[model samples]
Target: MQVDYEVIIVGGGPVGMMLAAELALARVRVCVLERLMETTPYSRALTLHPRTLEILDMRGLKAKLLDRGKPITTGHFAALDTRLDFSVLDSSSNYTLIIPQHETEKVVEEWAKSLGVEIRREEEVVAVHQDQHGVEVVAVGPNGNAVLTALYVVGADGAASIVRKQAGIPFIGKNSTFTAMQGDVVLKNPPESGVPSYFNEQGLVMIVPLPKGMHRVVLIDPERMAVPKEEPVSLEELRASLLRILGDDLGISDPFWMTRFGNATLQAQRYREGRIFLAGDAAHIHFPAGGQGMNVGLQEAINLGWKLAAQLKGWAPDWLLDSYHTERFPINTALLTNTQVQSLLFGSSEFSPSVIALRNMLSNLLQIPEANYRLATQISAFNVQYEPDREMEPHVLNGRRFTELHLRLENDVCQNAYELFHSGSFLLLHLGSDERLYDVIDWSKYKHVHVVRASLAKGAPDWHDVHTALIRPDGYVAWAISQSESNPMEAIRKGIIHWCGHV
Candidate 1:
């Protein structure tokens, strides 16, 4: 059998599903293929970042997800009963919502299906080829072999992606020497308060609370490690290990699922190869430290989805495709580097008494302003900033973040500044001191564009203090002007011309 679409995503995981949802919402036909018939029950990422929560909120999915996962309000760095509370930063996002990966997958799949996406399960791609015009993919389904041709192909498969391999993109980086055992187990006595605890002993042990009286536990060792198996983990062995490691802290009894795994870190040299591309685990993989794996993958899907829509609609330039690599590859590289450094810190041995003392001291010192700032930089996604090719206008709002301001329309509907971002249309917001600035823009000239009056006094400072700001469909501030009486139309015109590639 043969089929064709605007874009074909090569994995049905959370990232791929979300991408499909985005594309479908944008009226782009897409297909998603998966090797597994169903979602796995494992709890890979027990924590979701705040930025990710906000992103999902934009799609109206965050409230439902908040109900599924227990929020981890506080965190601790402990060793041998000595503990340091890092909950100060927890105020930013009181919880790292602990929901199973399967639940997340189901939510995304349901949402994507409602948006009209074609998802094919039990399909494995055997071969992939790409040319200037499009990509041809061959996969083996249950009934028979099937072929798909599409303008764009995305590989969200996994760390060992067949599509990535077929694309010949070099997977670079080193695998760690140490291994760890991780599993979701039901305990006899679960903690009343939901908070993640880290134990730094002979090896690192982490306890994360899950829904329905289960705890996602991890035990790590440098010399001895448990081997991975396809079947369910042994309940008896897990109980014994917990008894020895955790002692009386949290009683361990019933086991739901367990898995043993080694550590490895690798990144793709290029995310795009002609018409073939990679996202999520296919593009990058690293140690599961900091719980950044899934979050990074989901963000990649969101970033690429809209860009693909633009290109398919004939509004994006040729170089727009290359921007995916330019913007994401650096972020992936930084994440891998930070995770490696953190692993070294968390994986310290007791033999190094000096190192252990220094670590504890540093952990305590992390409560200070400077140390807190450094840790916050890693924990929060605010540290990431993409550098565009051309220089930004020299102004205060130039290259700064887009704030979520409140806007009131003539119809008396009060909403967020982002409402102007709907329909992937460019929005020019006039918040200048003089209302005359609004008269400058002839709204009738642009049919697809949105113009809004944003008053700072109405709500919190969502965007920076700029008189006039032009926002891209992807929610980026393309051009901004400070309070200026000078004819601002020239700046707006230049911004539109530059971003739309009309010049």
Candidate 2:
């Protein structure tokens, strides 16, 4: 069968929609098939970390989310007393946004639609078969069962991912040994201090104010810790847990949404299988610790989207597509480990004195500047560093996340560096305008790469003395050439071939 599109994404949640929008932004023809006719009103995942905001800024979507979300300068680690101070992180968006999942999804879905993505709602993909040529998908929709083909298929579906199962990619991890309760409700007597958190032998309980005079309550109770995640949570159940743990539910009432979740962590053996790939929860899942579940998935969408588009457009280097798995797998592994650790600290191991003591020590340690910054980077996902290309001249900036840089263009007009990535293309930023740059490489042949001749408008210690650098569409530095290099222009030529060319 003829390929219906370059890529067909199965699942149209925030992750799927973000990926589709990225592809469409790069001029890749893509479609999304989702089982739900509308976005979920339940806001299970409500936090967007800093790195997530940075990537969204790249696509000009950050401003939209900013308008909808409330920003907080701190995040939790095991519901510790001293939280991770995101304000210390060196980013414009060095904080988590307290926006509900429904709001996030709506912002992304509108983005996907604005970019011309064909979204087929109420379409459930039952079977996905991929061969050497392409992938065939069978889905049931309102019209009837239908078959469609695409050069590649991505499963952004959550925990019970049909695409991942059909691809036969084993999801390996441990089953849940304990669970916790979460709810968004109206609190007649809310926390006086705005956001109140308490951790003790009784159990951990935190309450944060939400929009529209509502409050989000999350708690772990020793008595109900072993309840199966499938068991539904009720308002009465929350009241009992609060009275048992916090001695008062802060007058908890009128739950807009409530659910029981477990620490059953898992990750796909590999993110890709032949012509099929996995993303978001389809690739990995963990307990809702540090409010990082949704952020990690959104970041993955940014990482995978451009690489797939590059391959489809024929300018992607041979190894580019496979690098998606190589780069993301280990990161998810670390994510699962951190979540497990957080779960253990949340009294999953035992709601006793020992865990409480350990958590107290860690929380106190986090008050120290050095310790706080390290955990802040990890939870905010600012610590991610892609392995650099060894063949290129070694520079400290290589493989590092390209944080915001102010550049003075050839015309001497200064602008923030992120504006270059609006179209989701490789950015060959030539900091020093050596006229020999164009003579060394045929820039026209690499039309997909956006070459900018500019110098640093602001004094950046790490970027000082850099002749040039190549940044991947996902905002990671592909490679950088040091000013110490004897032949910088020749290095730029090789870097372009190593990244921007299909060969």
Query: How many clashes in each candidate?
Result: 3, 0
Best by lDDT: 2
Worst 10 residues of 2 by lDDT: 193-202
* Candidate whose TM-score is highest: 2
Model 1 clash pairs are: 403-462, 403-463, 404-462
Question: In model 1, which runs have C-alpha deviations exceeding 4 angstroms?
Answer: 1-3, 74-95, 196-200, 226-233, 348-351, 388-391, 410-412, 419-426, 432-449, 457-464, 501-503
- lDDT, candidate 2, residue 97? 91
**Deviation in angstroms for 272 in model 1?**
0.8
lDDT per residue, candidate 2, 130-225, as tens digits? 999999999999999989999999999888999999999999999888888989999998878646688877888888888899999998888888
TM-score of each: 0.88, 0.98
